[model samples]
Target: MKLYQTYASPFPTRVRLLIYAKGLEVEIIEPPGFHASTEAKGDYLKINPIGRVPTLVLDDGRAIPESEVICEYLEDAFPEPSLRPADPWGRARMRLLSRMCDFYVVMAMVPLFNLSGRSRRHWTPEAIEAAAGKVAEALGWLEDYIGEDGFAVGGALSQADGAIVPQLVLAVEWIPSLFGTLDPLPRLPKLSAYWRAIQTDSICARLIGETRDAIAGVAAQAKAQAATSGG
Candidate 1:
């Protein structure tokens, strides 16, 4: 099995964490997607038409795209430690939380990434503000769902929790000024604690290493450029 991934992609980070947790021995291929290299765009697309990173190619030559789907496949293939709960309701809740993170939290971060130095010309003030607001709203929803539980679903470390870590880490790194000091949603003590706890895990530490700073530097430079251009 081979995993094509970019260090900066939250989607890939989720699968990488799952692979580590499952103790899977798959070859890790560094995709050129992170730097917007044409190789990833052209060659990768032959494998995955969407041209997304974190493409998992099985030894049998089957390719899997979409991070959540890849994680689901992994969970099914390797059930030890069981990231997804056994109970049907529990599984549903976990999937719900994962989708919330994907569609709400991750999607909100897309605009900011588009505003990075490499893509700064695409950023607009209106888009940034809209994305920021969506992020805040998504955080509130997560806080409500988490309540006093230590994890997102089943009251334990499950797929839901795993799915959220990379996005939250990215939020803290890219939009620190917005989510760091300010308690945007003060009622989310459990969620806040969960974030802190996940940060200590080695899988996350390894997968997201350096990318956070790199992405932040890109965002900062873009913002500076936008300001200069506007002035």
Candidate 2:
């Protein structure tokens, strides 16, 4: 099996974490310069027409797109390291948590991704606040789903935890950079404790460390570009 991914991308990172959990030996590939959507279609286009990241190509040559779908496939295909809850209702709640993280938290956070690296002169103050506001609002909803001091679903790291942690990482880091003093974690106790608890897990810690390094590389690249442009 082969998986297409970009190191710093949060969505693809989710799949990477899942792969790590199952100890699956899937080949991970980065996108070739351009996607199928562009005028010039790259090799990745042949398998995934949509040309999105995190497309999983199975052994028989069938390609699976979307982070969530790929993870579901992994769950069904590799059940040994179970990421979903045992009961049906528990599964639904996990899905609900993931859904909220994707639609509510992630969608809002997307706009703010590059805000920290760019000069304030390049972006509107209102735009930054608007996106942050969406995050805070959606995070309030997420608070209802988590416990006071455990994993996203419980002691085990389920799909819900995989889906939500990346978004929280973004908010925890970016909010202070974009807004002078605004912080998300302190306001959300359960969510904050969840972040602290998960850090001790080897899988979470390892992947999160890799992500931080990737994010740092991106910031350095942005700084170099800005310096060159200013010169």
Candidate 3:
């Protein structure tokens, strides 16, 4: 199996975390052509028309596009050291929390990125403040649903942790106030404790490190471009 992924993206990074944590024997690739800049033409585009990262192409030429589905496929294909809970409802709850990261949590950050990019003039500080409020609400929802033992689902690392923690890192970086007023910590008790707990998990720390590296790489490229263009 070959996985086209990049650590810069939360979706693909989560997928990579799953692959690594499970000790799966999949080949990972991220050539320049596989990146968004060269999305117009590539072997990646032939398999995944969307030209998105985290596309998994099977040995028999089967392509799985979405990260959530790709993780699910991995669970079924390589059941040992499973990231999913065995019980039916436990599985459903796990899925619910992961989906919330997509539809609720990260969705709040979309407006901020857009405001700085294409629609800067249209957005104001007031709009950003409102979006930050929404992000807080979404974080509250996750905190409420967090398992009692501190991990997303329990004492073990599930798909929820793989999917959610990368986004949480972005959340704290983008909105520093979410960390709290006096100390840079998660607002809620469960969230605060969970944040500290996941750090000891080497796989989570490694994936988060990948995100930081990718961020630094983008900054270096931007600096080089600005110097060359005298911008």
Candidate 4:
């Protein structure tokens, strides 16, 4: 199997983590999408018309796109140390939490990444503030759902944990001063701890290297730009 991916993509990171956890051996090709280059765009589209990263090309020449679908396929193909739960309710809960992270957390960070020079002008203060608020609300809901439990769903490191860990890492990367901190959302102590724990795990640590520094670079650039614009 050949996995095409980029370092900074949360979606790809999710699949990488799953691969690492399962100890699956496959060829990894870092595509040019990370540098915003067009080289991989054409070639990747031939394999996956959508041109999305984390596209898994199986040994039998089958192409699999989308992170969730890739993870599900892995769970089915390699059932040892299964990530998905056996019971129906457990499976439903894991899927529900995964969707929450996908739609709520990952979707909310899309605007901030568009704050480049030309794009920044279109990023209104109202819109940025609104997106930040939505992120906070979503984090709070996640924290409440987590309570004292160490993991999401049935309180184990199931598919829900694998799905959410990457998105939360991205949230901290794009919005460093936002969720996971004590001041912004005080009720998220458990969630904050969960984030810290995941960071130290071998699979997550290997997948997301020097994450704090990477996030700091982006956040610092954004903060400096905001100060210069006086908006």
TM-score of 2: 0.88
lDDT of 2 at 73: 93
Per-residue C-alpha lDDT of model 1 across residues 1-231, encoded as one tens digit per residue: 999986667777778777887889999887655543324365877888887788999999999998889998998898887888789988988888788888888887776655554444455667667777777778877776762455567766677766777677666555656333333434556678877665565765565564576555545655676566672
Better of 1 and 3 by lDDT: 3
Alpha-carbon TM-score of each model against the true structure: 0.80, 0.88, 0.85, 0.80
User: Over the stretch 1-231, how does candidate 2's per-residue lDDT look in tens digits?
Assistant: 999886676778778878999999999887764311123546878878887777998999899999999999998899878998898887888899988987888787767765655675757778877878888888989988885547777568887877776676677774656465388778888888888988887887776787677666666766676677782
The per-residue C-alpha lDDT of model 4 at residue 14 equals 69
Residue pairs clashing in model 1 are: none
* C-alpha positional error of residue 43 in candidate 3 after TM-score superposition, expressed in Å: 3.9
Ranking by TM-score: 2, 3, 1, 4
Q: After TM-score superposition, what is the CA distance of residue 7 in candidate 2 from its true location, in Å?
A: 2.2
Model 1: ten consecutive residues of lowest lDDT: 178-187
List, residue by residue over 54-136, the lDDT tens digit for candidate 4.
88999999999998899889888988778777889888888887788888776766665554322345757676677667777
lDDT of 3 by residue, 197-229 (tens): 887788888987888777556545644654565
Candidate 4: worst-modelled 10 consecutive residues by lDDT: 177-186
Tell me, by TM-score, which candidate is best: 2
- The collision pairs in model 4 are none
Instruction: Give the per-residue Cα lDDT of candidate 4 at 196.
Output: 73
> Mind sharing the TM-score for model 4?
0.80
